[model samples]
Target: MDLPHFSILISDKQYRKLNRNIWSEKPVEAELQIEDKTFDVDLLYRGNHVREFSKKSYHCIFPEITAGIKEIHYNAEFMDKSLMRNKLSLDFFSSIGVLSPTAKHVLLSINEENQGVYLQLESVDRNFLKRRKLPSGPIYYAENDDANFSLHSPIDEDIKDSFDSGYSRKEGSSRDDKTLQELIYKINTLKKTEFERAILDYINIDKYLRWLAGVVCTQNFDGFIHNYALYRNSFTGLFEMIPWDYDATWGQDINGEEMEFDYIPIEGYNTLTARLLDVPTFRKQYAKIFEEILTYHFNKQNLYEKINVMHNTLRPHVLRDPYVAKFIDDFDREPGIILKFIDDRHHYLRNHLQDLR
Candidate 1:
């Protein structure tokens, strides 16, 4: 299957500038070509550690393009041998009712040089909500562990300087930050009774639980405290989640090493999850979500079909990829790895469901 091809043309000066400051967030002027059309764009390196990889990821802002999208991300997925984990994980989240970013595989070319297959991800911003016909709201990215909904730093366990320490505002205003700050404060400072009553007003518990289930089932070790976006729904006045940077999922750790299916606890990590699960009613709701997903969505038989399709589609591409071509053998075995993880993870969670009961 031929994927959509994107060609980027940049001047030598701009290209040199990008390479000189590879770690910088500054975008250089570029022309992006899709099919027969060309549009001016701002292109820059994206991602944290992955930015340093030989096959770097990219962020592109289409100033002149009008496809109801302002920006797009091209993930190198350097650590993920299969290169399908991000899209697969996001698809699973969506299937289980979590509003994760949409992703697709596409071929990229820079200066007419083939850059191989890249996972083109939808940017989780205002446009994300708009496209889904969801209510417009303030969106913030959980950039690190401080986004853990605690007043302490996850790294050092020290009291945080601010309530919104781990988050970067992607959209919204100071008012949105106040709402997030208030939520964090209440989660940490409010007593048991007050918290139980006020928590529902601030967060969409059902959506959070489903997102937790998705994370646990997929086994994203770093997903709990970060790798997500928070959107405050205007109408509901409650915060919801959107997953991001899910390349290290489905039986693999962040380094693409094999991970035990039961590596992540069924309850998930993070203070918000801990506080929510502490409430008996919320725990039961979360347990029910786990049961439902395990019974229907997270099973090997059901997920293997999707896995096979993705694996087969990317197999040919992987063989030809410049960065991942050498790892084709590893890529070939990923379906089995993912499927086994699902089977084992399903068994583990079902047995542990009694804990919630």
Candidate 2:
């Protein structure tokens, strides 16, 4: 079947205005036609550096059009030559039982001009929790690059000040970050032995191990520090990690630079991860998780098959994308690099799982 289509309509004046200041948060009123239904949506150009690119990413919010879903993100996938990095990485995370946003490729047109294929990502919000049958709790978006849950003195004051600890609450009515602050305090000050005993009380340890395994397997160095969502499960009363913005996965850095797949430590990133690895039990669990991922999800054959399917599905659309052609020299060759990376990563992990301790 052909991919889904999204037709966006905006006045010339509004389009020019939006084009003038593409980075502005001021959303312009636009009409979106999707799946034979027309809905009024507020469209705003989103992303930081990608906004400056030739093709822009957009965030669309359907206030009254959709009751359950409030918003969706259209990623330009500018830096990712494969264009399937984000989608594939999210799928991997979901396969391993970690909560992540659903993503799919869709052809997008603006003002009747084809803007090429975009990855449409489901917004992770209250509705996301509802759809997944997960408890609704406080959702925090990692806003900055310094989301490393480190042990900084005056942690409570920093949380009160909203310092660049990289977290911003997107839901719940609590004006103060007492819950997060307490978690950080425990992570930083609790004695090593005591913290090991009490860590699972504050966060979902098993789910986190899976998340860490996913990051390591995909080599998403940026994920551990930023581009993720942390939400507290009201039922479990423990915070869980959600993967986000994975365009730099599969052995490529965010800038499309080739990365060493074996360089990423099994311990992964952030203070919480380091502390977890400090415990022998956590390390053993992490090794076991890696073994399971390699045996099932992160193997070369499985990943290569997924890559072939995505590449085949997107080839025609990518060839029609003038914007992609402007940046990538040979779109056809991009998938080969990803395939090689997957094979190499699987080989490295399979041989190095013992070194994780």
Which 10-residue span in candidate 2 carries the lowest summed lDDT?
Answer: 153-162
- Quote the positional error of residue 275 for candidate 1 in Å: 1.1
Summarize candidate 2's per-residue lDDT along 106-152 as a digit string, tens digits. 99999789999899999888999999898889898987665777654
lDDT of 1 at 75: 93
Report the alpha-carbon TM-score of model 1 versus the true structure: 0.98
Best by lDDT: 1
Q: List the residue pairs that clash in candidate 1.
A: none
CA RMSD, predictions in order: 1.0, 2.7
In Å, residue 79's CA in model 2 sits off its true spot by 0.9
lDDT per residue, candidate 1, 44-72, as tens digits? 99988887899989899988536888999
